[model samples]
Target chain A: MMRGLAVASTLIVVLIALALFMRSKPILALKPLTTLLFSTAWHPSRGEFGFLAFIAGTLWVTLVASFIAIPVCILASIYLSEYADKRLREWIGPFIDILAGIPSVVYGMWGVLVIVPLVKNIIAPLFGGYSAGYSVLAGGLVLAVMISPVIIHISVEVLRTVPSDLKQASLALGATKWETIKFVVMKRAMPGMIAASVLGLSRAFGETIAVMMVVGNVARIPRTVFDPAYPLPALIANNYGEMLSIPLYDSGLLFAALLLLLVVIYFNVVSKMILSGSKWSLYYNG
Target chain B: MDKKNNIHVRRLEENIFKSLMVFSTGAIVLALALILWTVIRKGLPHLSLGMLTQAPKSGYYLGKDGGILNAILGSLYLTGGAALLAILVSLPVVLYLNVYLKKGSPLAYIARFSFDILWGIPSIVYGAFGFTIMLLFGVKSSLLGGMIAVTFLIFPIMSRSMDEVVRMVPGELMDASYALGATKLETAFKVVVRQALPGISTAVLISFGRGIGDAASLIFTAGFTDSLPTSLLAPAATLPLAIFFQFGTPMPEVQGRAYASALTLTLIILVISVAARLLTRKFTKHVV
Candidate 1:
């Protein structure tokens, strides 16, 4: 078992580092890294370096998308885990799981043909926006729908794990269902919920194909949700082939990938803090 | 008396809200059903036997000339290959975590951290990683690279789920087996796995479902080849890739083909999901 654990842990990090290092060597040559990562000029074929535009675009969509999804997922999870009947829980649980498994490419396809049109013609007008099919609003909205299931699944499971005795005692004292859930159940499950939400947030942040198809793949400052923008993932995939024209361009793209990778790893570490039941003790110590 | 009547009114309203909430619990099902219906409505008309046999040549893409023969075969190979690779990589890690790591050991903590990190990384990032790793060995975009990327993507999920099966092995059973002079490995392999077979099987099925639906990460790693793959290193296209590439074309016939492919992909994913749920329910009943 010790040997196995050693192999597992050591291998993952090595694989991760090797995987990044082999692709354009961002750490080995840090001299140009600053200019590559921060410059807003994104002309790849000409060897110019910049990722500020992609970084801004990615954060913009993620913020808008998370804003739309987080509240709804929290409420829905509470309803299913604490309040729903066995029959309702039976179908809803698996349905959400299955929804999460749907490929990002499928969502992209739906976005191009269906969601793009809907946003362009219907949602845009309501929000006082333009009707460009592939715009920031379309991308963020699709991402929210794509990732909402992850948020719901993880949050609901954590809520369900709250102690039954606590819930029963509250109810036995004549506390109403909503009151019991609002105060007692939520408090007990708070840490786990935060962990699960962090997990969801990371999952949403890392999602690639779904957002790429709809994000309009243009390199620019995202001043408007209606404006077209390019994210790191989309930029990597879309321009990597075209970037073959210049090695520095390829290297710049690698740095962008590294940035995205670090962001994901950061979320992973945060998720662990939530998962190992560490925060409860850390709080008391602090 | 007026206060009492107002309280009564409020109680009635709460009851109505509670009942409504209970029924709204089916909202997920309704939402999925609606989405599926919309996709099918738009997608099914584009599907036919032609999609499985003939290859699209140009703008018209009509008649028997509109099949994703390469994609159909390529998707199966990549999906099947990736699923197999993930199951193999995860099984050992999960087994170790379940069997050897003490409940409070730092090794166990690190093991979990590894799984969390592996799961957290996005598919696109994995694709980029896979490309770089393979590129060093002089491998180009190919089915092998795609499979490797997806393996990384799904390995953590299956490992986590499989560990649940491991943790389910009754501690008493392990103790009893050890008390009989069995080695820990023998006991874990022989007894624990046997007892947790059903759960492990469910994990495999879930991983397969996830593997089939994966698309974005595979795109750059697995360049779409219209011909059936002759070697693992050869570029190949899956259904999702076909849908992505073909959908962008202005041709109605090609677009229809893309929709048809989507229909096929959805049906496959939905079937595995429902099957997994039913199988899990059966396992619970048997356990009781």
Candidate 2:
């Protein structure tokens, strides 16, 4: 039974690879694969299948989201691990977990009802841009909210590992609590914190439905955050339903899935190595 | 020479930073409250008993739905089937990792690493993978396909969580079992499983919550249907998709139903999370 379960668990990976290989057989030509990666125009109807635009859009949104999420996560981690009393910590901890539990689709719904309008009616007009509301900025903001909990949870764990004695040593030298955190805790937890952020980045990279509902799924390279854009996951999702309509269309979408899987694998492996190097295990060390 | 002044400045900075940290922590709570409030406020008015009991009407997307009975039943069926499949597969793998393989074995290490990596793969990717497999098998979207996709999505999570639990079973207990002439298999199934039941159930509940709330993964594999699913091969409706479809429609009544659906989904998740907590507490009392 045990071996059978192990085989079953591993089978999923094998099946995914096999499925991708089978699906891409029709468009295995080198010419199309290169065009699929490098072409700028994404009009599948005219047989134009460049993916650079979506790649750019995905990167841009992820970068913007990281900028927004990292600071809040670090601050919240420091507050939770170092400053909050036991009572306060107990109250706050569950909310953070609950934040993580909220479904992505609900986040998208919130984005549709809240964030998008805030971007459209408030933020956009201030920047002299039209508030179509479903722009890259709107998507990035939603992604930021979605990923902050992940970053906070990991970062809190990393911060908690900083030996309490170190803080006392600083305090014993007449340093204030914040001074100890700033000079001692942050420096010691830096690597693990960086790993936490990377994990969050990888998560944002693959998030689909929430980003889709807000990102204004135009298959063009966005010149500004206010402009509409498309990410790779959204592309696969929006087009998958219609993929069978055109020649090589199904294969094209499958290739995108393959690319996503490969990229995510690379990111996760790198993250694991980084965390291990920092002596941080995702599970409890005991 | 200005050492006294430097100390004073540092103290002031510390005070400012502490306040900032408090504010940021407060924001997390505020955010959660805001999300729940918005969902309830917008979703409450359209939430009716009929909405829960009936299927969507012909013009349901136009805000004239029967209740979301089809989606509710479909989600239940999909989550139930998928959760059952994942537990059966994961329980053995977890036991083997802890009992069959020696600690620090490279094979066990690699298996753990693989599941960790699998845990990070996104739902959309799973959907795409499922769609590809379905195409290869000449199968149409159906309840079975949706369960298969969700099974893949939750398998890694369930295994990893259970692995953590089983790993926590004290080594002394297993040794005592061996001393009593119990075989490794017997000790594993009889001893470790009883000890790890609470954690295992918690893992299953968490996965069920995940499977039920997911929309992207099931969208490709479970084609939507207005009628309730009667067989494994039948296409199914799910609350997440129903909410998505309803909210996207260009009608006020339909959009209102979207919130009601969102509320329903939230309430279900809330109940599951609470139940998981209660089960963990109850089972921990039994852990000897």
Candidate 3:
């Protein structure tokens, strides 16, 4: 009976994948996968379903978020794991948990009020341009803040697993504290850091309401960070309810969801591989 | 002199990097403070007792009077139902992994991997999948549909979290139970379950917090209604959706209400976090 339960639990992932694929079959039968993925035109009224722009938008937002989040989170995690005293670490733990627990909607609402204005009145103007503030940059900035706790939490865990003996040995060899961290600690934590960042990337990729709220849902490829773009998750979220009136529109949205699921799974599998291959696996599996 | 200068330069570099790390950490804390301040400052004025007690009056979206009572209640019902369902599924799978399966078993690994993938899959995909299921069953977007979708979204989270705690139960304890002539099932139920109850409860609360806060998964499945849902089949309102819809309106007053809703949601989450921490502390007195 226990084995039956376990097997059934494992099958859920397969079941979801199958259900999404089956739901998307109508669109796949109507159009080739390449055209669906490569074309930029998206007219639900007339059945022109193209996902290229949305995919590009998702990539751009995730890339921008990663560029901002990775370095900052790594630095913070280093401080937390290597430099922070017991008291400080204890205080910061609940803060990070609170950051993580805050709902995406609340984040979105905050983004709309604070980040949007900052971009519109200050950041964009400083760049010698004007924006409505609902742009890829805005989305990316909010997403960066949103994913920071995830990356930092994981990276700190990974960094803490670097044995103190190694750091002591480096110090005994006359290496500076910085040198010990940069060479001895970071070298050992590289694969785990990659896994942490990849996990963050997966999160930023799949995040919906928060990014959608700020990303001015225009269905076109954005050429600049200040321009607006519609991401794949947003595409499905905003259109799924109304798509029932149009033929194949529902299928198209489901296909977008399928695309998201596949990419997230891919990233997760890659990170899991990196994690299992590293010494951090001991820390994790234990 | 050259060697001394080089040492000075290295010391400067160390200081610079240390300061940079401090600055980055400071920036994250500042961002959190800023978010909280913005929510409180904006939402405070609009957050009244009427907003808590009353449903949206007619033209509420047009800046008329109304509260998010429907959304609060609906969110409670939806998340409560989903958390219950997820616990039902997650407990068995988590127990089967830690108790029934041997350590390092391939099936256990496969199950964990699958759950990790499921956990990574966007809530939007779950929403879409839930909608597909609803279509197949001829069900409308309703409380039941929302619960189903949220169950999928939080099941992995609950399972993985519970697995972590259950896995921490000492092997010797199980061995002791076995030596007492207990069956594997009895050991799992009486020994492991008792030990892991704190963590299991924390897992449930955390999943509940997540499920209540999630909007993307319920957007399609929980079709929004202004009125409180009377049955599982009726469309339900949720706090996140309430904020989203209210913020989308052109009226400033309605948008303000959105901030108020956001504030309410954040407070709910804060309470859950604190409660989970306290509960863990309270319950761990029994564990060895």
Identify the candidate with maximal DockQ: 3
In candidate 1 the C-alpha lDDT for residue A5 amounts to 48
Give the number of the best model, judged by TM-score. Answer: 3
Q: By descending TM-score, how would the candidates be arranged?
A: 3, 2, 1
Which ten-residue region of model 3 chain B has the weakest summed lDDT? B1-10
CA shift of A20, model 2, Å: 2.0
Q: Candidate 1 at B281: error in angstroms?
A: 3.0
- Model 2, B161-191: lDDT tens per residue? 8887899899999999999999999999999
Sorted by lDDT, highest first, which candidate order results? 3, 2, 1
For candidate 2, give the lDDT.
0.84
- Model 3, A53-113: lDDT tens digits are 9999999999999999999999999988888898999888678866688899888988988
**Docking class for candidate 2:** medium
Q: Per-residue CA lDDT of candidate 1, range B190-272, in tens?
A: 88778877777777777777777777678668888767777898898788888777777777767777778888888877787
Candidate number of the best lDDT: 3
Please identify model 3 stretches exceeding 4 Å from their true place. A277-286, B1-5
RMSD of each: 4.4, 2.1, 2.0
Chain B TM-score by candidate, in order shown: 0.87, 0.96, 0.96
Better of 1 and 2 by lDDT: 2
Per-residue lDDT tens digits for candidate 2, residues A1-286, read 5777676676666678678877777766744667777888777787777889988888988988998888877888899999889998987876767656777788899999998999999999998988699988989888887888888888888888889999999999988888888899999998788878887888899999889999999888899889888999988888767889988788878887788888877888887887775544553110
